[model samples]
Target: MIPYQKALAALACAAGLLTGNTAAAAPDAYPQQPVRLIVPYAPGGGTDSMARALARKLSEIWRQKVIVENRPGASESIAASAVARAPADGYTLLFASDSTFQLNPLLYNHLSYDPDKDLVPITRFAASPFALFVNADTPVKTFQDFLSYARQHKGKTFYGSYGVSNSTNLGLSWLSKQFDLDMVHIPFAGQGPAMIALLGGEIQILFGNIIPSSIGFIDQGKVRVLVVSGEQRLPNAPDVPTFRELGHDNLDTGYTLGLAAPAGVDPAIQRQIAEAVKQAVADPELIKYAAETLSIRLFAEPSGQYRDFIADSRRILQQRIEAAGIGKLDQ
Candidate 1:
């Protein structure tokens, strides 16, 4: 036997050299193909708009096609689960809201994937403030007026939300409990449907995110905003009071959107995606569109900080759900 020790050492050296070559080749020429961004909602929604903006910016920067795929159903869980089961090669990404990551896990008894474990938070992209609105024809002109009317009407008063187990629904639930008011919850397929129902007089009140589509109706005197559920008043809707200002600090809710990848993605790949998203969100055109058209506050936090924020949000939402006695939907 020609020196067994030397033979083993030679094998080790060869393996090390091959591993180095693979790493170098992979990282240097990453994203040699187009990337797919999965949005877990129907097209024409706020999430779809945000995803399209991100794709446009990233495609420009990377010089590679960034395609957006809408997989709407199950209140965004279907899309999230798809991304979770995708390859960890950084080719697939998920653009989702807090409901998919933080609230869904608590609201549903069983989920195909655990967001905290299966998804890696890349960055927070944007946030839209949730607001309380009533029909312009309704007698309620202010938050005080709505509350007083709600108390007197009790169960007769109603509020519509995007869907059951959504952030808006939970926010309204918590508010109703805190105020000792009997407000009926009307769940719709989405914000658009809920807004239509409100406009058609199917529902009296709506708690929703302030989007251009909804705000247009408000501007046309079809809906009247009572109070926004943000820490402070929105820049566009400065005249509307905040939940804090209305003496309902506990009702403050934020519906934020962010980018995430499946967990166990290579650290280098994670960094690359995060950098791309940071650049995308910071694009001047995107900023202008988000500020002027979407009326969304552009808040971006890097991967690590966003992960921490998600954890904190999950905890807070869990507490609120339990306190409100909200039951999970059967999966």
Candidate 2:
């Protein structure tokens, strides 16, 4: 194992995986008025869906409307900054992809809100592990096969991501180096175009989300999923092995859909919100929605575990970016 991989192995046990009975009732010390859940992405993507779902549940529990406010733009800095500047009250919370707390801070130098200083993690409600993909038309049928093929093809094999220095690029670049695959990287304007390129065979490889995108295609047989990230197999594809199960260590991270608040919120209030989330996550309706509609893994850990996960992820991602030889986006 490499240096980062060995380090990550130690975190395997400490990494956040919240599982238990529904939490007891919260103190309800906060949220007398309507609460605003700010989402950094537009109102249609997975993060937005997750925000809306959790907001609805929270609304029902708190009896105060939990409105999902979309402030999508600037690679999520817009919403992040807005929440960071908001009063350190329980009413204003950020529900966004963990990248806002992880990748963005490392990649963008001009970011307005310092995540480490301004934001406190509330809970990580859901996550979607990445699955390795290849077009069915490709001759390679497995990861090892693809590795051999890529080694033979060298410059001919291609991998693509939606943006530079983004999670997709970062992971793919790291994978390329770890395996010495020598595959070329291409950046698409967005995931939609990137998926289109993959389906059209313009690109041979892409890391796909387990839900709606990759899982949907797996049935249609348009793409072959060689492996998945995370510590275990996906609910949608139980037969597929995780990176660790396949003897590839340190590739356990996933796209986390979570909640955070401006730093300095009362720790008691944070615990209240986290308890509400834990109960909401255990809801049968949400369990169904996440598993069937969204295909997400639920981890309803409270503030402390959420904080630790973000810190560990940030440190590991920094090591990954450095290992991949990627520099800051502005530079």
Compared with the true structure, all predictions reach lDDT values of 0.81, 0.77
Worst 10 residues of 2 by lDDT: 18-27
Candidate 2 lDDT, 33-140, residue by residue in tens? 999998876544455677788889999999999998988666667788999999987789997575678888888777788888998887887877777888888888
The residue pairs found clashing in candidate 1 are: none
Q: What TM-score, over all chains together, does every model reach?
A: 0.87, 0.77
Residue 120 shift from truth in candidate 1, angstroms: 2.0
Indicate the residue-level lDDT of 170 in model 2: 77
Off by over 4 Å in 1: 1-24
What does candidate 1's lDDT look like per residue over 85-201, in tens digits?
999888899987887788888898888888988988888878887878797777899888888988998998788876676787888889888888889998765677778888887
- For model 2, name the residue pairs that clash: none
Model 2 misplaced stretches (Cα beyond 4 Å): 1-34, 42-45, 69-75, 152-158, 162-165, 184-193, 264-268, 292-295
